[model samples]
Target: MADIARRPFLRHLRAETTSYVQHLRNGEVRHAGAGIAFWFRPATAALAEVPLDDREQTLLFHARTADFQDVTVQATVSVRAVEPALAATRIDFGIDPRTGRWRAAPLEVLGGLLTELAQQPALDLLATLGMAEALARGLAPVRDRIAEALAADPRLAERGLAVTDVRVVAIRTDPEVERALQTETRERVQQEADRATYERRAVAVERERAIAENELANQIELARR
Candidate 1:
């Protein structure tokens, strides 16, 4: 009876040791707090879904990272998961896990997306009527390319993973560009004002000339009478 009791304890210890070894091998052990999946929209942020089995608990992680920087800007995203397991794999590898299921694919896709985003002209980003719409428009080509690439990846297609949104969270303009735009606007306004004033003065002068000619004609008629 004592041996049986001791066996359970010994087995538990062995399991713990094995888990620790696996953790060390994995480099970082992501406790399954909540299984998360990511859905990256073509022109918006990445949406993370949690509870790999259920679509409801999915959380979106709006990821925005600046060019040439290691830091990422993340917001709480709102999206649903089409493939829970795939989404979970994306979150684990893309955000936290060093060696996750989609490790290579996520990095490749995200890196390409970020690089393409960075290459976009600042003016294009600012000149658009709506930031989100503009970003979506801009990302059309990139999205097509990404889709093709993902289709080529057997693993991603098998999981039914898709990127849904990719949008501009915020736009940053150069100070010089802003100042130049302001100056141009002011100059244009001043030009319009000057033109209006000149037109008014010309009209006044023309009216005065017409009145003077009428007066002269009346004087001539009176003198002749």
Candidate 2:
């Protein structure tokens, strides 16, 4: 919704339900709250808007495993601003009263911070595991590690941000490496199958030999009788 209406020299501003707005005049806060409506002089008013709704950020990055193999990590992180006042102070959420648009990209700055925090723990964990181990068991452990780091980081709390959830979707190696592993597995399976077939044929030949010997013994006894 268009929250700003212009009439004469005064601009009426109404904040969105998901947004928390802070209005300041003469270096003092005049109004501060969510979904607030007020009128102010554009030249004398300073405005800041912080989003209170939860947002999900997708992250994709590469890391090296213990075996010196490179792998890609895909993850999603859910976050929200808890304190509008603190968040505004930490980042440039200031907007022009006349245009009602932010003077800076605050969300991009937050996303960059989150990406750095999430990547650190994940990279540390992957560096300790081999490629196969990372692919097999790295997802949950990486997710937990990132979650713990984000939750415990003082910077996030100071900025009035909270990490609601962390999910690691996949840990994958290079395509050529994956294909090589698959080929090795397929060869092992084929060898086992061949061995089983040989054993079954040997058992059938032994049974036939025993049956022929029993028939020859019976014929000899009948001739003697």
Candidate 3:
């Protein structure tokens, strides 16, 4: 990442293969592309570097379900700059001439953008479903819904960003709610187990009665003989 060296009034810039470097001199593009190096005067040149590699951002947020149940959503969104030139224009990917580092946090800006874009659809979808339904069918549906929303949003295209993948890691309620649900499930399982045990005992008793009756009939036959 140390791709810049300070020269006497000039700076030497080297770009990585994963980064798209744009060199602007007096409001015109002098050089642009990935993995290209150039020297420019510090006073007159503006440099912008946009990373083209895919990045995964972890997102955690809260949403309310249709039944007014509050749940936390954890997700990961994979994204990349599809058009580096346009991205450089949209976001402040500009780097200081002295250091090959961004003057501002461009990636953070992208993260905020992605978080908003991903959260809205999830909120809307969860709002339409109850907590049970959301927990039961939320993972795939939420992931797909977010993917669809990101893919269809024109803002991303205009900003030269694209969503590569979306994954819903977890949708969980509060600890108290979670414990209550767990208790309910556990009780249901215990009831089923008890029923099964009772049925097994009943079958054993019936089998024993049939065996005893058969033995008695055999003894009576012997007595008659």
Global lDDT scores for all candidate models: 0.36, 0.90, 0.92
List TM-score per model, in order. 0.39, 0.83, 0.93
Candidate 2 or 1, higher TM-score: 2
- lDDT for each residue of candidate 2 in 1-225, tens digit (9 for 90 to 100): 228899999999999989999989998999898989999999899899998999788888999999899999999999999988999889888988878899888888888899999898999999999988898788899999999999999999999999988999898888999898779879999999999999999999999999999999999999999
Looking at model 3, the pairs that clash are none
Q: List the residue pairs that clash in candidate 2.
A: none
Most accurate candidate by TM-score? 3
| Cα lDDT of model 3 by residue, 86-142, tens digit | 999999999988877899999889889989988999999999999988887789999
Candidate 1 structure quality by residue, lDDT tens digits, 107-214 = 344344334433333223224334333332434543344334433455534444444443333232345644665687799999999999999999999999999999
Question: For candidate 1, what is the total of clashing residue pairs?
Answer: 20
Candidate 2: stretches off by over 4 Å: 188-225
The best-first sequence of candidates by TM-score reads 3, 2, 1
Clashes of each: 20, 0, 0
For candidate 1, what is the TM-score? 0.39
Model 2 CA RMSD to the hidden true structure, in angstroms: 3.3
Candidate 3: what lDDT? 0.92
Q: Higher lDDT: candidate 1 or 3?
A: 3
